[model samples]
Target: MIVGRRWGDAVDSWVKKMQSLVGYRTFTVLTIVITGLLLFLLLINGVRPEKYDIQEFHLSTETIRSIKTVEDPVKTEEERQRAASEVSSVYQFSEEIGENRAAIVTSVIDYVLEEKAESVESLAPMEEQVSDLKENLNVLETDGEGIRFTDGALVSLLLLENESLINLRDSLTASIRDIMSKPIRSEQVANTKNEIERRIRGNLEIPESVLPTAVLIGRYSINENETLNEELTQARIEQARASIEPTRILQGQVIVQEGQIIDREVYRQLKLLGMLTNQSSMKPILGLILFISLCMWLLHMQMTKWRASKEERQRTLLVVMLILIMSVIGMKLISLVSNNFDVSIAFLFPTALAPMLVRSLINERFAVLMAFLTAAIAGIVFQEGYSVVLQMEIALYLLFGGLAGLYVIQGAEKRSHLLQTSLSVAVVNFVFMAFYLLMTQSDYGVSELLFYGIAAITSGLLSGALTIGMLPFFESAFGLISTMKLIELSNPNHPLLKKILTETPGTYHHSVMVANLADAACESIGADGLLARVGCYYHDIGKTKRPGFFIENQMSHANPHDSLPPETSRDIILSHGSDGAKLLQKHKMPKEIIDIAEQHHGTSLLKYFYYKAKEEGQSVNEEDYRYAGPKPQKKETAIISIADSVEAAVRSMKHPTAEKIQEIVHSIIKDRLHDGQFDECDLTLKELKTVERVLCETLNGIFHSRIEYPQ
Candidate 1:
């Protein structure tokens, strides 16, 4: 017998060890997968792509000139060459004519000066006549000769016609003789005047003859020696250098040579190239994909933590994915609409509906994170500047909508709760939108305001609709028990609750008191009061199977303990918790609530029966009478355990008052603390104290002053 017991104990121990090891291994794998997903997302989103290069072209004076003269065709190559040769021939001839004219003018000036210096009196008339002639010569005509007198003249007739002519001629001759007799004062002036006269011989014709010649020369055409392609290439090369090149071939012109500053140009070119490369969509695509993946991983972890059941996990994920898809599609539709209408609809790209729906269906923390990620991705995809504002608005809407849902839908029961939540979300969104518009000083008219209001309402309604539509799928997939379902199960008319009430009235009463105590305690500790209350309602359901065995249903009847042995009685009492768990499972109760019912006793000793047996001199083990239980692992379950014990203990009091109830509550809580009943739960010492106070108040209220029923 000892060997058999030892072998059984060893096997039990090995099984527990293996279970722990498997759990640990599963957790480790999950952690690794989540971490790898996060890392991959970071690598994809966090890193930016290299930019493209652009070539920078500079404009120069030569380029401007080329552009300006591009329309003209007069400066061709052949015309430029011919014009150059003609210009050379004309220049040589002009030089020769200038030299000869200068010499003649110099000799004529010297003769006049000699005549005047030698015979000043005799040459007075001639000097006067010469001055008059010089004055009239200003308007004279010429034909490739010296100035001609307009009036006809004959020298022979002038010598014979009159004595005055002979006198004038002889006097002029004498003056000429006198001038010839005079000594020269300055040879330089004579040489200069002679050089000027020779050069001006034919070319220095009077204005009347030279004006027409000037006009003809102005019309002369010149030939250019370069083709358009050659000119363009030359211009480009010169532009590459910092030189000035002729855009057109002109006579007596040369192209200027200047060195190139490669460094400055190269830097500008590289900068442009870099800009072009940076603008590529590939980098943004990679970054967006990475960001989205990270968001998914974060959401996955958050959902995993929030959901205690597989169905809940699946539901939250589906809802989140649906929200994201809807947001993307809505943005795309808005983009298309805006483009088609030629309006600014980019503001609607980051759909506020996505995060709003997520918050309504899942939770706020995940919604906020998803909102930011969506905004960032929208900005990247749309390539619009207003994506930032859209993102901010989306985040704000998420916050408001999530708070509304959490506030109105907490411990929800009916579908009407969803409607209420939607209304709350709409109100919050409208108020926030109004505040935003006021802050931005927007010039919105009544129509615009109405439009915004409609949009906000639509978004809220959509969120609620999506939540309702998706809730069933999530519930099935994750096997989650929502507050709504819990409330429904807690109804007094529920099949199981009715069975307990009908079969074991005493246990039903005890369950009611337990529910009240648990609700008060859980609420005080900021735990799920509704879950605790409902859990307490069904905690003693197994007593219905054998109603007569429990004391609750033994009203005014003989005690069954008289017939049953202490061990049998203890087993019957202990078996109820296990039986209740089984019943809960059969009824498809959530594991969380089932755990509360199962763990309420938590292996506590059945001291009453055990000590009773001991006093009778019976050999008995205490473990034999102890309740079979798994210890409470959560705040709700721990709260339910304490409430169960305290409610039963307080009910046993002969006379209960406010002060008595307070004392009893404090004592129960203190004992539980000393016994380490709350060690596994997340409840803090302060919360425990709060729970005790609330329980005391609730008990005092329940046992409040009332007139005794008339006998």
Candidate 2:
């Protein structure tokens, strides 16, 4: 037993010595730097393109080839556009061309008829009428492609006199209007003119000379009336070419012959494949380093915003860095397996494991940040020179899965909760994966979908199992006091707590009241109430070693301290702080609880024993009656000290009132302040006043008067 005790002490001392050497700031900076370098190394190989320094070397394999068949997008688009532009232009027919020409021919005939009528009324000779009519119709001579009439046709018309010329004019106007009303192509103008002249000769009995001249005028007046419809024509062309398929180059095809020079086509294929080797440069490497550095810098800034203590921030960084490294390594291993077995096996990787662990064990924001970081790292670690689209999809899958895991474990408070959280995560994973597959419209067989579904489900369950198995190790290794661990320690069934309850019932009852007082007071001051409550439960555990000597456990009227010397009693009373700490240490309690036990009394004077010795004419040093302490180093421990004093002092009073409780609480705080017991802690004067008020209220409630029952 003695050897085991010494061994435990030695181990604890060694741990403390090692802990003292670790500088929080140095550890944080070093861990971040290491994490950045590791990320840069992992990602550089994937991000940096392979270059071939083929100074004189010939092609080894059939020049380079793309792993997957892909369309030459630029070439395909150009071909489609060229095909669309090849459609012929469309034209719209206009009717105004036929109408205006028919009107011009009627006007010339009307002018000739009017001149003849005037000559006849004046009783002029037929020759004079003919000459006058010819002179009046001469205006039509210069009109080409309009209403030009030849001299012979005019003379033939004058010979016909009034009736014949009028009939010819009506027939000519009707022929020109009917023929020119329909759409006329430029190439079909002659055929249309011939058809109109044929119609005039067959359907009407006009003179042949008049007929030929009328046909000439009709043909000349009828022009092509169709005009280009640009919008409609272009739309038709685009619709015709919209179904063109992209041209593609299949995988493993020869890009270039072995002995052929590296042309642009071959160079493009090699660059696309990323298979060229032996040529290295620093540009990609530097860019990768910069990217990793930026990520780490942003993570650091986020940590600063959290405002965690120096030591806590260091531990958090260390934990996150270690988890990220492990995640990256796991991804690389999984990728290797995927490369060897099935390429789809990479989807089975539980990228959420680390983030879930972080969420349960550390801060939620830290878990979320780590989720994003792990996703980025996994992208590089698992990439296999696939298309950019595929790479991005893989990264997004990991990111969503990690974030889902975090969301599941957001408010998890127990180990068993992880299993249920895992189920929720699995649901999220499957939903997201299904959405992704549908969104990308990737063709998949039933077996492929099933396989992906299984992988997604397995990721969640596996992550939860890993978190459950690993959390205890992390808690023990890092000396972390998680809420789960605190809950376990707070159980009344705990060995140390049960010992105090059974062996020192008075002290136990007193401790419970102190817990109430400390919990309320600490909460009011924004200190750790749970920690203070649990600390109070074990604060006076040393009193169990000598229950009869402490007044609280003395149920009988007789006092044990009456027979004991003041020096002896003082020694016993003062030793409880140290003794309680030792007992807690033997039970391997958390250091926080031990500190509360050891420092609650501080070095405050044992007033009763000191005054007793002084009244006896003994030259006792005042320091000799005080408990040994290193003082409270935190607000929780310091508040526990004040509550411990106030509880005991108030309980000793006969029928304590609210005003008396307030007075005693203030007195205890004042004495501690004057004695410098609070000097080592970060508790402020305002917090102390708040603590006093909370204690007064709590104590008043505990010792308040109750109504008498009717007997």
Candidate 3:
């Protein structure tokens, strides 16, 4: 943003060369388009745009905030995993497995009791009976998951009483039925065997030694009755996954803090949000382009009212672009500061500066347009995040402030008037802020109110100060003839005016009288009276080169024209127009004043010397003695041309009565009309007659006859 002086000059020169090559309107359109592009870039950068790149588990070096609300997919997925883990795997309770296990246990118990009855009925030896029982216990491997027992445990079971055997069977059958009623996965088989063993030991009224035989019968009969249903377990998992809600990442949320490690979860979220991709969305760019195009279109329509010359149009457009670019940048800077600090200080933005400057340097319509422009841009720069329609609160307040400045800055033609206008703008700003706060239902204490009031006052005073400071620079740079510059040029103490007064007294007096007549005549014709008066003061500045050579400045009665050739005298008379133009240019006077000085005589012939050459029998051409002129191109210069000659010719009249003054004024206009001098300027016939009548009246007043007192 800080451009070097040499670089600035190079760019200025390049722009001027381009303007000359392309012409005014084409170059101005290009400038406006370029300005719109710049605004788009500035606004898009401010509109909640953030991106970052970070590897998983790496420490983040910067803090990042989200500009939109979206689901954190990574966290949501983690929650689903947890919910699924918390859900128990579903299993089926198989009634067929329970019935088979119960039948197996009853069959084993019947075999044990049959073994004891056979041993007692046969009166068999204890060893033979135990051996027979061990053989009998191995019924088949097909009963359940096939049962087995040790030889010692088979002997104890063969010795058990029948009553104890019946009790053991009942307890074992009931415990197995109750346990198999609930679902269980494959991992619970060993624990189920232990539960059956404990129940058999508690229910049997048998010897402790025979308890192992009874427990073995019960424990070995139980098998895996609850098998996992694959389809039903999968359904449960899916239900848990669906139950987890996605985690929402809200707008303005800080996704990462400095020095925080980007773990796998955070990394996934960043990827989902497009932060790590470094690829910005095309929506913001496309939207900004369309919006900016519309803004430039409005500007093109508004610029139709800028009434000026081609060069002035180019100059004013350049100034307008500068003011706009600077104003937007100022607003952007304020937005950045306020947003960063989280302060509610938007009222401090100096939104009125552009409108005041535009109104002062150009027309009020352009100022009004600029006010809307700044306000709309404020809407963009001050928005908290990306939105279809930006916040209108700040935009509306800015609009009122800018319009207030434009409305009151018209009275600020003088520096003293600027303070009064500033006061009015400040009051408007305060009232608007007050209305805005009340409308939005903002709660505030006295200190907060004071902050708002001070900021409002600052916005207004700053606008006025900046306008006054920059006006002179703009006028000088653009070669604009602003009213303040015109007033400064009209001062009697100006160096050019003093030079005319001191060096050529008679010409000075003549110029002043001519200025009065021209001023009065210009007023009557609806021309610039001030411009004509100022032009008359310096119209004859070239006479200072050789003051005595002209009749007005001649001290002695002896005519210098008597000795000099008529051609030489004619050359001296004709040289003042060009010389004055050159001198005024040297002093860097405005183009309008310089044009008046050069174009006033408008190629009218010096008849005195032309006829004198013919009388002396010297060969001469009539066109050769005429003043070199582009002619009067404006109304003020044409009126000054008539008044200049009118004052000079009538001053030579003897007994200058009102009748004679009117006759001479009429004669001067008739001569110029016949000579085609007023042909170029768009002065209507009625306006010329009015000029004629007003000049006569003014001359009559200056040269009125007075009654001499008898002494």
Number of the top candidate by TM-score?
2
Ten-residue region with minimum lDDT total, candidate 2: 55-64
Model 1 gets an lDDT of 0.57
Q: Tens-digit lDDT track for model 3 on 19-80?
A: 87997778988898889878887887865356775688889998766667789776788899
Better of 1 and 3 by lDDT: 3
lDDT of 1 by residue, 463-500 (tens): 56666665544443334455566767888899898898
- 10 residues in a row with least lDDT, candidate 3: 1-10
TM-score of 3: 0.62
Off by over 4 Å in 3: 1-16, 46-291, 294-307, 386-393, 520-528, 555-558, 654-711
1 against 3, candidate with superior TM-score:
3
- The sequence of per-residue lDDT tens digits that candidate 2 reaches over residues 646-709 is 8888888998888888888888899999999988777899888888888888888888988889
How far off is model 3, as Cα RMSD? 14.8
Of the two candidates 1 and 2, the one with more favorable TM-score, higher being better, is 2
**lDDT (CA) per prediction:** 0.57, 0.76, 0.79
Ranking by TM-score: 2, 3, 1
